[model samples]
Target chain A: MRNWCLGVLAAFAMLVGTIMPAAAQLHVDVTQGNVQPLPIAIPDFVAATAGDETPAVNIAAVVRADLGRSGLFRPLSRKSFIQKITNINVPPQFSNWQVIKAQALVTGEAAMQPDGRLRVDFRLWDVYGGSQMLGLQYFTTPENWRRVAHMISDAIYKRITGEEGYFNTRIVFISESGPPTHRIKRLAVMDEDGANPVFLTNGSYLVLTPRFNPTAQMIAYMSYISGKPRVYLFDLETGHQQMLGNFPNMTFAPRFSPDGNKVIMSLEKHGNSEIYVMDLRTRAVTQLTDNPSINTSPCYSPDGKQITFESDRGGSQQIYVMNADGSNQHRISFFSGRAGTPVWSPRGDLIAFTKIEPGSFRIAVMHPDGSGERVITDGWQDEDPTWAPNGQVLMFTRSYPNGRADEIWSVDVTGRNEQRVNTPGPASDPAWSPLIQ
Target chain B: MMKFSNAIKFAAILSVVALAGCAEKPKAVPAAPPAPPAAAAPAQVKTSSIVPGSAEDLRVNVGDTIHFAFNSSALNSTAKATLQRQAAWLQKYPAVTVQVQGNCDPRGTREYNLALGARRASAAKEYLVSLGVSPARVDTISYGKERPICAESNASCYAKDRRDVTVVTSGGATS
Candidate 1:
């Protein structure tokens, strides 16, 4: 009996020694590994068992590209899959994906109904944890499958990052082409990944910043169509537009109030630019700022009780925030160089802007109180920072030195992911829209 | 040859006679050149004064010479053509130095324009170098819409502002 006890003790000691070194090595490797983009695998949805007639555009492909372009996820190619996704009973061989270093997996099944409706059920799995993270089911018209895919991507993103996903959003910008001297610009809107881009206006006259309403169906932009730089409100549904007000001076940089009832813009009258808010229904104008210096780019807080704008009032252009009724203004920018185009996030947590350092132009974000200033992107030239619906990401314009083309770029608030959004022609002034139904 | 020179002498005498007969006559002839020279002087002085060294030396600095298009980092057709002419002139002098200054229009967000302007100036310098112009003779810098000939918001102003002006520098030699 004493020999048996001694042998058991020796075996336990051997087990501890063997396990300790391996665990320690694993800990060290994890810490040293690049906390880079998480790799995910999304397989094509299996057709419903009930003889359905939904046309599959291979929507999985689109979702994969959208998430992959976000720079937050590195999607695995479908060719490397060991098992088919059509069989719902059998889960993905997570071990096979683990071999390929995929950290997460997404699988879905789609079916068509007699009423021409499509039902999709998706499961998100964290391969590393070897468990399901989220399981979502959605129903929509057969033609609306793409939107469903985007929403799913958004859901997965929000679950993993703790911030809302911007994949389901849209971007309204100015589509530009022609010569450098007299280039033509038109108001345009498209899916966040540059899909289904629809031109809201022809490239007839000069059109500046086209910002979206919170609902994402209306737009407030500065257009020279009326032969004067005035703020114009456009409805995507009716294709109807109306001038906000008849201010004698040019109105540049028009934005919608958080409630979408008023238009906030800069009125350049008698060589002075000041911030003003105009009610769309009553046309009653209220001045938010009375500074002599150039004050423009007014954005409203999510609650509509406060305003943030860019002003040269502090000698050089810097960001400042004021109460909704124009009281108790405070300067927020503390950077060494100039800051302009202060856009308040929809979430009302921070503001995005452009900062000019010696040789580089960077897209940056900062807290509402002007603290936690961080520059997310820096290169030859990146500017016109606009926020995604979630306020977790920003899309801006990036111009390279070759003079070949200008492209749109997006970066996350954490500054980890930076990517170039593909567009057909040179694009700029990207304004992100809220998710449309 | 005699007729040409005689015509010049006769024209000179007639102009003098006309000036003496009516003082406004010679005043108009000299006024044409003088008015342009004075106006050009102030405009050139303001632009060139920003450059280093004496403005009288006629050796415009890199800060005052080059320009670029809006959101562009490459020299335009006119800029390239002018630079080619400048390269040949530099080769003729052998000791002459030049500076290429880059600029951009004010339509873009600022920081990008600055880098874009720098890229334009560098591209001009590279092109000049490829054209047998000595790289050492050509220096480049970007103003990035800081200065404008026409400040009004229009395409004409933007076009003129987007340029690369070559300032021919003398190698310590006076013309």
Candidate 2:
């Protein structure tokens, strides 16, 4: 057991080294609207040994897919490449890449070390400026090649977009199947690109709204265990599950504190739902909202100073904000339609939610002060907006008008490149994790 | 003696007519007889099929489900009448305990719909208790929009989805 735990820890802690300083010769301003995707070229990573060929080629393909999906980088096909990269230690042929209108290029090499670990080195280059923009190396077990690929993608994305990359992340969601009347929903986690999916529970009972803690590998979700619906916590490493609180009534819509020390959720008693907070260490609970109206879906700001939730206290469901101590509560949404499921961005600048229009529901985002509300997607039924760690993108669940299927979709904060994420089956209630360390 | 036998036959014919009338009614009438008394010799057969004080009796004889408006949990006259029958059925079967499940249409956010479903279930439970059912014998759960009986997105289907159903959990006979 001890050896197993140590192995898990080692897999999580990949050693990273910066070999060269990044230059700003080639940059993409992601904050601006209507920006063009920068053309990039990524050839296969050269393998130093015969046995390392598979990992080298697979890593490069994953990195290319990651950057291409971000919508800020358009990866040029290998068929269009003019020069074949044989050595990553040396700079690429800039004139060959320049003829293809490639603004940036990425090259890497993978080798098996004497200690039975994989050593991967990558460098991002500026084609026009003819210089190395960034260079980095990582050491990890050979089996964790996908994570290494994601980390390399993050480095290239950060060097170009001037923002943190979300490639090194995981998404936890409810994998749904069966028919509409008797659907089976199980809690499942996967890579951000929908790889290595593992089901945490069997589909005996229903589960919904699995949320990841910002600072830990723990998840808080609602489940109908033994016919009682309540909030429960699951440890990702140990696979141990426990009910969050022993409240006399139903507890659900749970979210973690920004620091991951407390859990805030709704407690229903005698048909009235109110917000409550519990310290995980002490298991002590405190009431946050005492209104008869629904005060659920509570989320804390990145600073842990304030909270945003959805409530019907003012007749229709709308988004509201309050202090951390439950004082000075006020509604922030005054639009014509109803709004709910408010999640504060990690950057603490915007809150993403679902807007109920006349005939449809759309995923939308607004500033903390209730200004600059923008509906990003126009699906027939789109809800449950979760933020990317950098707050530059949002993922949500979209249901078809036929009411037979539900799928997860992602869109940019600037309302561009709406695409459906691949899952094994019908899925919903997606929660994106922070960047893996 | 002949007049007494004729009176018995007349009463049996009247009850058969009443049962036929109830079958045509839109809602399930709690007071309707389970079978016609004209077939008195086969009374044991009818009782064996649908045992009194059973879960099937509560579902078929007395109404087991009631619906609410789009976003409101306040019970209407139709819903109240159904709960009254449910209370009578529970009182007759004192050993039975039930769980009221609240459901909603897929028109609202999940968390809010869950809270709304809880309200709808509580509304039914409260009415049953007010009509003399013991509070200890009734429990409540909210399914929100997770379980919808109707899959279409039309108003009629939505109305069917927004409902509360009482299910016998323990100590009830099964048929």
Clashing pairs for predicted structure model 2, backbone only: none
TM-score of 1: 0.67
**Candidate maximizing DockQ:** 2
- For each candidate in turn, the TM-score is 0.67, 0.90
Off by over 4 Å in 1: A1-34, A49-57, A93-99, A128-130, A401-403, B1-104, B107-159, B162-175
Angstrom error of the Cα, residue A19, model 2: value is 9.7
**Local accuracy of candidate 1 as per-residue lDDT tens digits, A1-437:** 11211221221100111111111111111111224767788877777765542433366777798778767677898888776666544556778768877778787777776766677777777666666667777767665666777878877777676666777777888887864445577888877888777887887766767888877778888776865556788888678888777776567778888788898887754345678888888989998888666677778888888888877677666788999898989999967777877888878888888887656778888889999888888767788888888777789988665244568888777776677886658788899887654
Q: Quote the positional error of residue A21 for candidate 1 in Å.
A: 33
CA displacement after TM-score superposition, residue A102 of candidate 2 (Å)? 0.5
Clashes of 2: 0
Second chain only: TM-score per model?
0.61, 0.73
